[model samples]
Target chain A: MSVLLSATRISKRFGGVQALSDVEFSIRRGEIYGLIGPNGAGKTTLFNVLTSVYAADDGRFEFDGAPLSGLKPHQVAARGIARTFQNIRLFANLTAIENVMIGRHVRTRAGVFGAMLRTRATRAEEAAIEARAAALLDYVGLAARADDLARQLPYGEQRRLEIARALATEPLLLALDEPAAGMNATETSDLRRLIERIRGDGITVLLIEHDMKLVMGLSDRVLVLDYGRRIAEGPPAQVRTDPKVIEAYLGTGATSATRAHAEPAPAGARPGAVPGAAN
Target chain B: MNRAARPRSPLAALGVILVAAALLVLPFALAQAGTAWVRITNLAILFALLALGLNIVVGFAGLLDLGYIAFYGVGAYVWAMLASPHFNLHLPFWAILPIGALAACVFGVLLGAPTLKLRGDYLAIVTLGFGEIVRIFLNNLSRPVNITNGPQGIARIDPVRIGEFDFSTTSKIAGLTFSGPIKYYYLLLVFLVVVIVLNMRLQDSRIGRAWEAIREDEIAARAMGIDTTSVKLLAFAMGASFGGIAGGMFASMQSFISPESFVLVESVMVLAMVVLGGMGNIWGVVLGAVLLTFVPEILRYTVEPLQKAAFGRTIVEPEVIRMLLFGLALVLMMLFRPSGILPSSARRREREGRQP
Candidate 1:
């Protein structure tokens, strides 16, 4: 498969502390690439760098072979990369459909004059945006709640709405900061199906998740990070078996070493084991 | 599919039509009541236009611009310079008004470009300082070259005229004699209508959605591919454009321009109108501007006379009472209905079915 995104030696620092260092990964076309790490392991930091929320201190990346250096967050988004926040950041006062419609900002070209004049083209584009936003809401099972304020939705539905909003950008690559961060078992499974279905739509997903079960179950490939460095990179089964990942999660000692090898081979087979089990 | 049908739509349309018709006939109906009330109405409408402009910045874009009246001053000065006898320049009203608005738009961009990065209170402080600076410049620019005529101000500004009908003078039309205030009333009404239409269209368009997105969450808006910088600057410029147009109208109607008229208090008053009316709602801001304008006038008529009769003197002045009451009303509104009288639809939805 063709590489959709490739990062090289991406490093970022916050004051004196290094948040991310020499982190490199690539997402292939139509693949679900999971990024797993311990808390403060720079997974979200890496996502931030990729999305251009923070400029990388020491490296560059490419999206669809276009260099991503010096691009602002909005510019990155205009290049067809969309992301959801680790915390829910829906336009809470706006309706679900309105929130999703904002995701079409880059696609729509109506300006102040056209809007104020209500030109024929502006009306048609607005109608098209409404239709597309409604379709995205329906895809996320939020069609009925399209007119409801986003904050009025339940927690799980809010998470789903965020995903729907990201998808409304018509992105080639979707980066979900933590899709299953606070979900219950059913919601987590639903998110898994949704992520898989997103991949089926031919959009590559780069997911940063603490829920190991969801990551292991949904990801085609997994990269593990501990303390701002990659510890393991492979398929879920191999990454799960890596002694370093277990040591990073459970900590250093004989106890963690024994638990790392004593765990059953098919533990990842269960779809919903524990919420934020690795964190 | 399950969205609630807005049953008030037809009723609201009828209400609007009725209000428009009343406004059309208001100057004529009040013709016998002296020209002062009609002039006051014109002033209120002008302030409404200004409030609408400020709403685009504070309400839609969620930018706290405490110095909005500076744009009003810019537009007024532009009109003063182009159409005033002070410089022996007498451009036509239509030609000069647009120039005034364009100048204000340029100033808006200049101010916004440097200050958009500062959010919340920092923005407010910067805008307040900008407003003060503009006033000071206008106040002092009359020195040496006598550009703005110092504190004495510019006079003999030209009135709006279409063909042979000069708005400064009364004219007989359709068998009815229209006075100066009546003529300005109609002109200002037309301008207000255009502004209202533009405001409504903007509130529902893609640009409006983008502004609202930035207001809700800047980072999320950027992540959604909105160029927040350009959009914020556009908000400032668009908002200021209305202020400029209204400023031109103010200059022409009053036949005078002075730096004293564009005080920080005027900015605060316009901001109060937007906040008291409901920030993002066009009609709400209009109601706010009108009520805020009239309420003090109404209080003057009622309270001063009562104070005179009760205390045998004007001990408790109407102006002081008006200000106190206004401040109290704002405090109460913040405590009770923080969203204002007619909250924007989004805010209304969010506040509905919630505990007080």
Candidate 2:
């Protein structure tokens, strides 16, 4: 598979703390890439750098062969990298469909005067946007509640709405930061299916999830990070069995023998135990 | 189906038509009652225009602009400079109106551009300063080179005229005697209608949607590929344009201009109209502006007479009582409705039907 996004020596610092230190990863086109790490592992920071929410201090990244350096967040979005926030950031007062329509903003080109005049072109464009937004809402199974205010939707539906909104940008690489963070079992599995379906549409997904089973079950490859550095990078099976991955997860004193006794099962299993536990 | 999917009933259509008809005949009705009433109505319409403009910045864009009257001041000064005898210039009302609006729009951009990064109260403070700065300039710019004519103000401003028909002079049209105030009433009404239509169209447009998005969440709006800085600037400029238009009309209608008319209280008063009526609802703002304007006058009629009857001499003045009641009404409305008398459709929906 061709590489869709590549980062080299990406680093960021926040005051006295190093948020990310020379992290590097490449996401292949049409692959489900999982980024799993403990809290403060710089997963969201990496996403922020990629999406140009914050500038990388050390290195650069490329999207579809073009360097993404020095671009603004909106410009990055225009380049087809869309993301969801760790905390859901829906336009709370807007309708679900309106939220999705706003996602279609980069694709549409009607300006102030055109919108004010409601010219034939603007009308046609607006109609297209509405139809597309509705389709995206339908795809996410929230079509029935298209007119409902985004904040009025259920939690799971709000997540789906965020995804629908991200998809409305017509992104090539979709980055989701803790999309399944608050979801229950059924919702997480549903999200797994949704991610797979998104890949089937030929868009690659870069997911940062704490759920081990969801990540291992869905990701074609998984990268592990600890303390702002990559500890392991391989398929789920290989990464799960890696001694260093376990050491990073369960801390320095953990061994392969105690790995089985770990509360959350081994690396690529259910996520009920701490990854960096000392026991 | 969406709740808004309900088809428009004929009754609603007829209600709209009836309201429009009443507004069209309101001046004539007031004329029969007293020309003074017509004059008040004219001022109310002008304030309505100012309120509508302020609503765009505060309501649609969610930018708290406390100094909106500065744009009005800018527009009035532009008109006074071009069309008044103070400068020995006599431009036509048509030419000066747009010039005034453009000047205000430029000022809006100038004020908005530097402060785009600030949000909420910081933005409000900067705008407040901007309004004061403009007023101070108009007040003191007469020194060295006399521009605004200092505190003495500009007078003999030209009234709107079309060829031989001057709006300041009375004319018999359709067997009806159109007085100056009555003529201005119709003129301001037309401007109000145009502004209202433009506002409605903008509220439904993509730009309007973007503004609301920015209002709801600025960071999320940026993620959605909205160039929020430019959009916010546009909101400021557009909102200021309306203020400028109203200021030009005010100059023409009053045939006088002064810095005292564009004080910080004017800005707060326009904001009160927006907040009291409903920030995002167009009709609610019109209602707020009309009520705020007429309420003072209505109090004068009732309070002055009631005071005379109750006491031998006037102890409490009408102005003080009007202000007290106005403050009390605002406080009560905020405590009860919070969203204003007619909240925007989105706010109303969220409040009424929001699921847990």
Instruction: Report lDDT per candidate.
Output: 0.87, 0.88
Q: Taking the tens digit of each residue's C-alpha lDDT, what string does model 1 give over A188-214? A: 888888888899999999988877678
Over B1-356, each residue of candidate 2 has an lDDT whose tens digit, in order, gives 12233365699789999988998888889899888999999999999999999898999999999899999999999989899889999999889989998999999999999999999989999999999999999999998999999998999999999888899988999998889998898889899998988887787677888899999999899998888989899999999999999999998888898999999999999999999999899989999999999999999889988988989778898889999998999999999999899988754465345432
Best candidate, lDDT-wise?
Answer: 2
Candidate 1: regions farther than 4 A off: A254-279, B1-13, B346-356
Docking class of 1: medium
State candidate 2's TM-score: 0.95
Candidate 2 lDDT score at position A9: 96
Fnat per candidate: 0.84, 0.67
Instruction: Give the chain B TM-score for each candidate.
Output: 0.93, 0.94
What DockQ do the predictions score, one after another?
0.58, 0.56
Please list the Cα RMSD from the true structure of every candidate, rounded to 1 decimal place: 3.9, 3.1
- Number of the predicted model whose TM-score against the real structure is largest: 2
Provide candidate 2's TM-score on chain A. 0.94
